[model samples]
Target: MTLKHQPAYIIKMRAKPGQGDRLFELATVGMEKSGASDRFVIAREDEDPDVLWNVEVFRSEEAKDAYENSPLADELRDEIIGLLAEPPMRIPVHPYSALPAAPS
Candidate 1:
């Protein structure tokens, strides 16, 4: 079996009142349709009444890229952008590790 890589992204948005719920719903649905696994709501911080933060981790960067290019992604992006009070903040992460076992 091929091992999947780790990909994590932190998305920060300043959303208008009542917009977070819709954005969350749209994102979750789109991610699932694009082959994402182990999805969960990581955290929601109330920086203020009009600002919010979300951190989500995916199984691999390939999965995340596929989701980004989906038709649902386009729709979600448009809708979410319209509701955002500021540009969304996005950061990509790649982690590395060394296996304990080595070939002789």
Candidate 2:
């Protein structure tokens, strides 16, 4: 089996008032435009209407780096940041094992 990057990233943030949907949209768009993720999941917090969460599994560190350098990031920089109540939190993890071994 071909080995792949196992970088798991978790992002949690609070959207600006009435901007939850916009934030979520931007999140998905960013992922779609980057083409760097193996899996991407988005969700809202149970108790906080403004809270947003994203789980992204990137194919590799190189993939993630490419995403950071992507033009999409610059394109949405203002809009996404404006929709956020504060800076988003990003957590990166290195996994020991995973199914599929590679993202489809």
Q: All candidates' TM-scores?
A: 0.67, 0.81
lDDT (Cα, tens digit) per residue for candidate 2, span 19-79:
9988888888888888888777788898987898888888788887877877777778768
Give stretches of model 2 more than 4 Å off: 1-5, 96-104
Clashes of 1: 0
Q: lDDT of all predictions, in order shown?
A: 0.64, 0.80
Report how far residue 56 has shifted in candidate 2, in Å: 0.7
Lowest lDDT sum, 10 consecutive residues, model 2, at 1-10
**Stretches of model 1 off by over 4 angstroms after superposition:** 1-4, 47-49, 95-104
State the lDDT of candidate 1 residue by residue for 7-94, as single tens digits.
Answer: 7666777777887766666666755665654343434565564455555556667776777777877887898899887898988754
The prediction achieving the highest TM-score against the true structure is 2
- Residue 67, model 2: Cα distance from true site in angstroms: 1.0
